[model samples]
Target: MTVHPDRLDELVRAARAGGVRGVGRRSFLRGASVSALAVGVPGLLAACGTESQVQTAESCTSEDRSAAEKALVFSNWPEYIDRKGKKMPTLEEFQTTSGISVTYNTDINDNTEFFGKVKDQLGGCEPIGRDIITMTDWMAARMVALGWVQELDMGAMPHVEANLKSDLRSPTWDPDRSYSVPWQSGLTGIAYNAKYTGEVGSFEELMTRSDLKGKVSLLSEMGDTMLFMLLLEGADPEDFTEEQWSGALGRLEGYVGSGQIRRFTGNDYIRDLNAGNVVACEAWSGDVIAMQYDNPDIKWVVPEEGLSLWSDNMLVPNKAEHKANAEALMDFYYQPEIAAQLAAWVNYICPVEGAQEAMEQVDPSLVDNPLIFPDEDFLANAYGFMELDESTRQQYDKDFARVIGA
Candidate 1:
């Protein structure tokens, strides 16, 4: 949580190279040949949180099949793993050492879409055929609240118990992360192609500036985009009343009506931004970092209002076919050496406590990178959006859809 001033200064100097290039659709694992373009994520990720779909009280029981079964399945976003050719080095090693073959699937791009696919199965306590699934914070919270995931046997996960970052320990949804573990954390902020526009310092400026009008795109995700609007309206996102939320939504409607905002986006903004068709947009920190590598003219901004913070978490779906095997994979990833390797590749804030020290050995330059290892002062300027319940989540999604014309 503390970074030395000298180290901070040096990192700042290095960061002038236009900050770190971020990861694409974090947790994304693809065919390795795909040159990870800029960040692009579906709004379905942000759309998760509504409990109106289906509800269930049945809990999935875990049985130790590890004695006979040596296989597990993991589904995550694309382009997230560390690799060498077609083989994932870490996963390969995990397989060799633990004798657990992994069926890794990068099919999870949208949290809501994935949930819809399995909700029927999970609601009935039927095996979803997957052992582990990575989800955004809000979606994971919804699953845990519905008892759709198994409570992790922490006794079998000493590495995780010892290595989880302190700040992430007590989220409002999962006080102890009993049913989830943070996979990676990211910031939602402003990203602009500087070659076409000057510094777009604040969300208010981006929303109203003439040149940026029709060229600006806000994120489709409700929490990430609406929270910034709430801040601009002088409301605290972490704890806001229904009235405050209404005011924020009203502001968004005005921009859309005025044609100042082009459209709502997930990952498609990356293509438009690269082609210079879009001048500025609401962007994720990891995506901006990744884009900067390809074009230094690309810039990420932490608006005066503050950045929205979020985490993608890992969970064991209820009635998973291989719970113990999934836990083994979870424990293996908690190893600082492995966590650092993944963090170095993905370019998000690592959630494992000791990964920073391990980062020194993997890539010394990233040791002081603020994006990878933000200290207290930097984190102070970031805030998470208001947590939502069933009725509120449904209403907010409805409101957001009307504004975005989705």
Candidate 2:
């Protein structure tokens, strides 16, 4: 639940020196190693079941015991919160102020893998024992569609209602954000080693520039990679038709066939880019930020095509006994001060709006770090991928997998 402060400082130093790197939040979505890439799509498909497991409040009733129990259980990704040894200073403050006993677990590695672990119970409208579970947009969308999560009392989480970034407030699947709240967000864009190449400008250049041929890499995740391809083909990624998807896929296939692409990658692209083996590639914001500390030549660019904006969200599953308590925790973190502390440590985009100003006190160095605290204009070019049904998603993932040599 917490990291030692000294350990945290050491991590910052090590990351700057390129001697250590924490896993990018979605790195596990593809594979831990390139050799294991083939299994990634299949794993995701297994989580996106064919049949709808939809439920209603009447069908799966839940009780709120926060009035008496004063306890909450939360599961999140590793090192996601600000910490000092076994104590989370911000969370400890919440427990003290609200009288809510908290149990936090960092057990989420891969979204689909975590889904597999809880699907049977969630499908049956049973409690998954977690009051709060953090998930990426697609997985959250799937769970919300399945009716496996509970609607939040938005009025009760006033901080979240007030501070959540406008860009993240309206995901297609939960347009009104009735069931999910973002924990953190980041961008997917162009990253290049300045030592090896001139500034790479856009997705179009990454795909067609002869100078970058056989030296560039793309992310292996379908949504992150294909979104850019869709943009290149003049298709809106948020509302593309099947024909548009095929066109994008065809363009990607052409690039691959021409040997213009080095390989599709997970976080392993960091290794190749650092060694100059990969001159330019599609990259995550957080990884590029860490790499820059060691290699100032490692540059991140908001592509001419646009950026892919995504988040890890928090949701309360159906039948969770501590719904109110979980809501309280969500609200607590949404407070700008607490949000800034978390952002200072995790270095992801803080989803709480006023956190940038609050960072003036928490860590002034990060106050202007665009990767961690981007303004609205900087985020204007960002887009989210279209939501899809299970069958369509499965087919698309399979198509992407085959082309990427997964």
Candidate 3:
């Protein structure tokens, strides 16, 4: 999920509040901001006065010490794994089975913040001390573009080759799936508190309905929020033009200017939605699914325009010493049993093809949950954002931040 600022302090506090695990499983403590989370190091490029900071194996040599080290350093978002009493069942199982000790860190609260912490090291082809880092699509793409991440040995990951879902196999940035592996995937859709209003079926209704005016919050993430705008304009988000982008941005600007939209929010929208302070809003599917467990008033809808699909990918940064061990870990998780266990706890879309049947043995309750294992028809209308070059991505992000008042 994308995050935002203003409530950043709250985001930090929430991210660090509880002991090791931070918040509850599926808790809403995302820490992304529109401007800050826009693109990977746009501000850094401007500050460093660099045209590009690209690398390759020839330019930045890497070594695989997995045979000797037998250790890995991984970083991921808080409360993202399956946990019970401070122990991650799936992770512990991996360690026990693979014998690869992992130094798992939950330090990635926001994509931008994490990027800031590592951009300096990555740009200079130095080690960021991370074997596997989980980040949303845009950040992953940026790292891949700059060649800051290592290419995976797919030959070692047979499970991934056989079980990875078709839609997730070829992201534009990593079309051949050489560098990044998805940790988890999720969808962006509309959510309305039934206690506050009737079912809100479409994005258009969320924006233009009179009674919902000033009570609807759009997502702060550019791609998640703008994909629908692109769809509403009869344009394909996966391959839109500069003209299409401009038209979509202008339409969103009109909604914001007319006071039809309440505010642009990150995961913090969960609080406003729960309190009924905001009736209907653009929301993440996983967040809405988790909310429904406690508050039946929350309802998620696949907007008429369609859904925005994104994934938090697993990447091994350049200079990570445990390349083979990291590859081992990636392959281990792709096993249908392990993937189902993770999906049962995280409640996001499972990217493994055979995980649905595996869920019958892991957790029968989740066997039929669409959010966890959506069928082909459910995802037919789902769309991903168009890939952009760094400069163009930075420009679109700047434009998006301006419209969202970030």
List the pairs of residues colliding in candidate 2: 3-85, 4-85
Candidate 2's clash total is 2
1-406: candidate 2 lDDT, tens digit per residue: 9999999999899887768766654565545665466667788787876775678888889888889899999999766787787789998999999999989898986676688799989988888899999988988988888888999989999999999988788977899999999999989999999999999989989889999999999987788999999999999999999899999999999899999999887657888999999999999887687678789999999999999999999999998999899988999999999999888877789999899999999989899998898877888889998989987887997898888872
By summed lDDT, which 10 consecutive residues of candidate 1 come out lowest?
Answer: 31-40
Clashing pairs in 3: 3-32, 3-33, 4-32, 4-33
Q: What's the residue-level lDDT of 32 in candidate 2? A: 65
Q: Report the number of backbone clashes for model 3.
A: 4
Q: TM-score for model 3?
A: 0.83
lDDT of each: 0.84, 0.88, 0.88
- When summed lDDT is taken over every stretch of 10 residues in candidate 3, the lowest stretch is 26-35
Arrange candidates, best lDDT first.
2, 3, 1
Q: What is the lDDT of candidate 3?
A: 0.88
Stretches of model 1 off by over 4 angstroms after superposition:
1-64
Q: What's the true lDDT of residue 30 in model 3?
A: 41
Lowest-scoring 10 consecutive residues by lDDT in candidate 2? 23-32
lDDT of model number 2: 0.88
lDDT of 1: 0.84
State the lDDT of candidate 1 residue by residue for 32-84, as single tens digits.
Answer: 33433223235345567544434443335656576698989999887667767
